[model samples]
Target: MNASTTQAYEPESHADQNSKNIIESIIHGLDTFRKFSRLYAFMGHVAGSFFSSLLAVDNLSQLNPTFFNGYLQYIVPHFFMHLYVVGLNQLADLEIDKINKPYLPLASGEFSLTNGIIIVASFLFLSFGAAWMIGSIPSFWGLLASFVLMTAYSVNLPFLRWKKSTILTVMSHVIGMTMSFNIAAFMHMKTFVLKNATSYPRSLFLVTVVMPIFYAVVATAKDLPDIEGDKAAGIKTLAVRLGSKKVFWFCVSLLQIAYGAAILIGASSPILWSKLFTVSAHALMALILWNRANSTDLSSNISLQSFYMFIFKVRVAIK
Candidate 1:
């Protein structure tokens, strides 16, 4: 009887082990999803512009489940698009990333190249298909432009790898970001949601124009942390040409100037609250940037990587 009991317990224990393995696999997959998709980055990239347009149009009063569902509809494809953009870069820069970002799924051997290709291709199709189905002209064109530019930026081909040129790289980033983040988002809200005469609000116009300058800083600053890999890979990023320390300070000064401009614009606002709020927020932000920059150790790889992430946070905060 004791032998029979042990035999029965063994089967149950084996079954429990199988169940645990399945659950652990799922958790691991989710973790990989987070790393690959960079979901928070997507939020920072699109959420501000998307909702800012809605806010400008006074659409908050229409809040409901349906509104949120529509929001999901709009963002899901955009998120997939973001995944494709970043993933393609990783795919193309596997060697460079092995040096600069070894922990990335592709470079680290956690996710296979075949799997990465399949997923990225699927995301590209999904984004384009969803855009066509939604029938948003601005979004479709903007997505197309981004697809082209990012492909050119990453893929090594005859006369195609735009990342080798600082001007082309910066232009790609600025144009792609402005089109996808500002113009497409705002126009989608205008043409699809509002469904009336087209007009740009003061806030939206300012964001649209100023966003390019900010994105230029973002583009240049991103390369600062990748100087080693980029230099080895023959990429001519500003960080490579000028040295990381010099490029770092240059990016900081550009952002500071942008903040100063924002403060000036806020002061010119007719409303007292707008003036007070904008001026105060930008001033605080500028101070925070300088403090962070002063503390950063330019020589340390870890410090440079951390500062790169801090730059993303600043982008989201400003948005």
Candidate 2:
């Protein structure tokens, strides 16, 4: 069964409900750990970004055997990047999360701070080790960059704070994604940038541009549901800083703008018919967001769930 479904069965009372609560809480804590880390988003984004760049390369050149072969080698670095981001994001957010996301594992008392330290240690070991195994110092540096930025945004780095500023909040996403895209491009330079411009198909550029824009929007969309807690905690996210009305308009406007840009870019390019699927997915999401954003307050769980679902849908579409 699903984690949430399993989580729902925890008893409210029992002879030893406190002990049982602790166990159930641990389960829920793990679930929260999985959910908020944006692990799925990170994986999907890396996969989409990498493959779209590859497809761009394929479309630009005659299909060569070497280009087609050994593509799986990329997955090692991709996994390393995703693992680092997911684990680090969760660990970094632990403090702000207590205020803005009280339902999270640590905030909800599902896991102790001591347990959290152990988890973070394990996550770092696996992440850095994977990066090192990929045989690129740059890849390991990228892993380090992920940890540093996550920490800067969520915990320390008062000098470069994004947790309490709307502009910085959105800018952090753009910067992070830009770094990911550039690092991925650097790692797979042969496929991402070797084609001559005169011979390069426009389809590749379309994918590169559209994918990152989609990622930025998905990241910002997450802020909508956190406004209440953010305000209470003095975390001036886009939602809290702009207030609900402006944030609503901002998200919708971004969705429409990105959708329009994607459609136009795709139509003008030579991307395959299958690639049009991402556009269709975004159109459906726009409709879903419009309907849900109108009917639900930002603080409602349904609103938060819808935001999460949209991120998942975007990931699937791009992949």
Candidate 3:
């Protein structure tokens, strides 16, 4: 071939290589987004928030705000809580993620701490802004506490870990449950007060707070799958402290007792039967979740992931 012909071939070759590189880069970027598990994190906050909200406020229609404030309340707190949960998981599972979830954006070098920090800041700003819109100091501060817990969990503080302090895990779950419940309750209250300010029932206040604690116990079962990861990471989850079987049975008993309690509550109380039925449904769902929680067969590990996914699906379907 002549020199001119050779030159032409070289440019074509370079062009082909560049095209391939660009295509690969695009594919990898999309894959990294999936690994970040953003949707799953959002679903966690949504689930916790939805159930708690259901318990607190009976009517969903009363949340209308005059400005963007209404939409902000509905969206911002959950956004912050969800992102915070994702960041904390990535931070805590730093080692375990290296093994099991290396494809995660941070673990795989597809994303950076700077990127994570930016995302978290955006969430916090949106959350705080939403809380401000709600016009309730206590509830707004509840969201602020949610942000604080998220920060505590994401950063390695002096005394907080799976090994060093069960208080972290305990308080984290309790606070999360309250955040969700309170949002729901606050919305419901506005609805009730708007419709019949004079006749607003008082019992709802008690039920909203109590119900999330019970459901929170059921959500604790997810800690079981993380047992090995938790142990390796030197983290102390409820499963680690309670024993896998113990955690399973304890959740099961909690579900059963909650169900029975609802039946009894309905039989003797003047409160809404729907409230009892709602708790009953959650307890039944927990019982169903317990079946997978008790799986000792070891061969069904993949199935267990599916089971949890199903739980998530059902929770989302409820609201």
Candidate 4:
């Protein structure tokens, strides 16, 4: 009787264990989805599309259904490119991420390194393939430039890990952001069959100059919260080299200069309404950034991170 009772209990316990294992696997799958691709960052690409759309249309009246369709077509490839770049970075920085961003899928063990590799590979194939399918030389070149920069930043080769050096890091970001903007802008221009390779517009030139400076600040500030992890990993980021306080002030000054320049441009715009709106918006953004920077508690990583996102918001406003 005792042996029979034990045998009956063992089967039930095994079944229960199998169910628990399945549930755990499901939970981890969900976490991987949440943390791996980082869907929130997709908004940057969407904003790029919006700016491109604005530049593509001659006026509000020209923004019809076709314009919207073109935006979708252009944005899809951009989105995959972002995923590929970001995913590769995440994969390459798995150790650093374990220190600086433990909640990330690969770092947290919610997703295996193999899983990350597969996802990034898929994104890369889709991004380049989609760009080719679009059959726009400008768009393809823009994506190619972005891909090269992103690869340089992530690949662990001599002088390739641009994230380790301050100057290289800044240069990489500047070039990357410029390429990202151009990718969408050029795609929009292509959709309308506009004259490609013509003289650059004043607005385009301004954006090209401004975005790099803005991205420089963001790139430096991003390292602030990860200084400890970066130092531990022997990655000499700007924050690690200059100290967080100096880097913070440096980012602030850069932002101030950017906003000042925007305000000046807005003031000089020939259109009266454009002048007022741009000037007012930039002024407000400057004040907000200054206030946030002052109130930011450097010791609180969350606070610093939030302020960084706020900077991104200000950037979008300028656009």
Q: Tens-digit lDDT track for model 4 on 51-96?
A: 8556655566656776676666667787888888888998889999
Collision count for each candidate, in order = 0, 0, 5, 0
- For residues 1-319, could you state the per-residue lDDT of candidate 1 as single tens digits? 9999999899999999999999999999898878877666676766655655564365566565545555555666677788899899889999999999887889989889999999899999999999888777777877888899989999999988898888888899999888877777777666765565677777776576666778888788888889999989888888888998998899889888878877887888999999999899989999999999999999987898788778778776665
Model 4 vs truth, CA RMSD: 4.5
For all candidates in order, the CA lDDT equals 0.81, 0.58, 0.57, 0.78
Better of 2 and 4 by TM-score: 4
**Which model is ahead, 1 or 4, in terms of TM-score?**
1
Clashes of 3: 5
lDDT of 2 by residue, 75-124 (tens): 45545456555555556666656766676666666767777667666667
Clash list (residue pairs), candidate 2: none
Candidates sorted on lDDT, descending? 1, 4, 2, 3
Which residue pairs collide, candidate 4?
none
Residue pairs whose backbone atoms clash in candidate 3? 53-184, 56-185, 57-188, 162-235, 162-236
Cα lDDT for residue 164, candidate 1:
89
Worst 10 residues of 4 by lDDT: 190-199
TM-score of decoy 4: 0.87
lDDT of 3 at 130: 63
How close to the true structure is residue 130 of candidate 1, measured as C-alpha lDDT?
Answer: 91
- Shift of residue 34 alpha carbon in model 1, Å: 2.1
Off by over 4 Å in 1: 59-69
TM-score for each predicted model, relative to the true structure: 0.94, 0.69, 0.68, 0.87
Better of 2 and 4 by lDDT: 4
